[model samples]
Target: MLKKAGIAIGLLSVLTGYLIHHPIPAKVPDPWLFQILTDVLAFSELMGTISERVGINRWWAYPGRLPVPRWMNVPEGMKIEKTVFHGIESVVVTPKGFAERKIPGPAIVVYHGGGWVFGNIDSYLPLLVTAAEHTGFLVMSPEYRLAPEHIFPIPFEDCLDTTLEFMSRAKEFNVDPKRIAIAGDSAGGNLAMAVTVELVKRKIAGTLVQVPAMQALIYPKLQMTNYLLPSYAQNREFIFSKDLIPKFWLSYIGLSSQYSLAQIICENAHIDFSNKQMAEKFALVHEDRVPTRYKQRPYNATPQSIPSDVKKLLDGKTKAYLNKMMLDERIAPLFASNKTLLHLPYTHVLVCEYDPLRDDGIILFERLQSLGKESSLQHLPNSLHAAASIGPFDKNLYHAKQNKILFEKVRDYLNNMH
Candidate 1:
């Protein structure tokens, strides 16, 4: 059995080397190991789709969970425990000797990303450990509800609940509640955005507690209002492949099998624009706002661009439901007014140049800047979006160097905060 296992592993390694180096895939950059890995993971969506149909989609939970957290090596003396935060299950990780410290430490509430369909504390253990050790932060990660099962807004609420639980329990952990941060990658980043918007709108803990000290949105999916973004045209296969975006959304919104509704929503035409002026303003990506080269080519689309048949999906009760939710500050935080943005805490936005979500992050940062908000933007021009999650293990020369710089920058951003 040991001999057979060794041969299987050897063959897989050799295949990976050949796929990454010899011919080299396009759009996915060299150090192609990361690209190959992404491709493999992306393919799992097919299995996920089948599993969803069979009512076993949450398989990623039981098996994927059991192995990852058990194997991860955390910082020496880091106290890892499972706890309840406002009815939500969470993994609380603390730096060594945190409980005995005389002074309160900064804290971060992190969310895990799996296209909003699957991801749990176990999957994010490594990243949380890295964050805690590097930034000297007390990290709390909520085990939020996932969808196609829980549907939209439920996941956002879980995050909000956990955040408040942290705030309410801050003193017990020796954490300065006022110095807390919120962060996540991909779908988790989206939740972080919604949570920030909600906290600002609702006003919790009198003043500063509602506003986190900082937020890191790593490769977040911001707006589905437009599909003509430049990255969509350029990156057809690498990270966030063109075909999967719609499927992921279908799963998130619990409409995977509804072909017509899915088609319209996927094309960015699902929302009913009652406020035409604001909707028009938010519908398209602001060309002049982003980096110069992104404007090298022009993209033009209008409400009329999609056929009338698709728009029919917006006619009944579904339209009324989405009409309110689509513009909800939490659901489409980008639709948030400048006045709302001005009050937000310091934010660090990460954009992967080759990602479909790239334009969304860049434009968001630009908007925040125009509103005079304290914001920072980091653009990974040569790398694909969503690479942060898997980059830590890539041994390829280019992947190793760039990935290290990315995480170090993240740590520095959190650490240098005054």
Candidate 2:
């Protein structure tokens, strides 16, 4: 009996391990290596869900909870420091020899991307370190509160407040107040632009704070009004299912437990597209603005009707609130007015061709260009989402190459800053 039990347990363990390492392959171009990486990530998401259901800490299976790699250690030429501003903890990475400089230099206040709820400052250290090393500038990442608890405006407010405080005390960090920029990846990219818009609006209204000199957004989630983007359908299962995008957005807005609504929102049912205000804003995300090459996938603009059963799931108050939140410029900066767009700081948009958020970044750049705003864009045709965050730690050759190219572009942009 003991021998039989041991054999059964061993077989079960092997099966579990295989399942964890063999998640359904995403639609990304790199099916071999990136698939393996995402498979592990998918298992982590499952663990996180199970832990949540069991009333255990959800972070136990969180991807950001993975052990840091030796490669992610502070690069030899960089030094890190922690400071508190507006009751939020922030990590600052400075290039070697920053202390002895006679004059203050440019700096970047970055927001880490984890779809809003998953990542922390430490999870993004590798990217921050690379930015500091490549750009030779002070880099800081705010540890903003995450969601399912903190929610939309709370996390957004935390970033905005921390950035304002950092700018006010820039001298202490050896950073030039006038040259400070705001940057972020994914959700962080959304915050960076939101913060920039808020600061510019404040400055326009005679506020005393200094506006960010630039905004660098990496494949940012810029709008919630339209999920029918070409990239969305094309790369729905690229890194993770595009269906998960609504889950993250819902989590950001504090509706995380409404899991059933994720698919509804993915079909663009949460939004009443015929509403005048919503239609106008969503038109900005129109496929026409997307370049001809990116339109390789089939996308139908006809709105998907909300089935009666699903309609019953959306209460009046909940639908109203979701509509309000989705259209807010602060939550979806892509809807900001041309007047506001004109005042935007210099901008750099980095997009990955195989990512769902690809069109968001591209449309943003195109809008800024149409308004004659000083802006630049870099599209990584062979890359996927989260490359900036995951590339530094992955051992894969393609990841390393993509990461190098990502940062090299960043470095050149910062170096050329006036």
Tens digits of per-residue lDDT for model 2 on 10-69?
A: 998888677566433244444565666677677776676677577654544565656644
Q: Estimate, for each residue in 1-418, the C-alpha lDDT of model 1 and write its tens digit.
A: 9999999999987775554332223555554566555544644543454565676653353224335545456668998899999898898898888777787878888998877776688877867776676667789999998877787878888999889978888998898887788988888888898888778876633564457878888888776555556665555455433436655665666665553454565455665566685467555454445677765644443323556776675577865554555556675677776766777888888777667778778888888887788888877766776566554453455544554564455556655766
Clashing pairs in 1: none
Which residue segments of model 2 deviate by more than 4 Å? 1-33, 51-60, 65-73, 297-308, 394-418
The local lDDT score (0 to 100) that residue 217 gets in candidate 2 is 91
Model 1 reaches what TM-score against the true structure? Answer: 0.81
TM-score of each: 0.81, 0.90
Per-residue lDDT of 398 in model 2 = 60
Q: How accurate locally is residue 251 in candidate 1, as Cα lDDT from 0 to 100? A: 62
Clashes of 1: 0
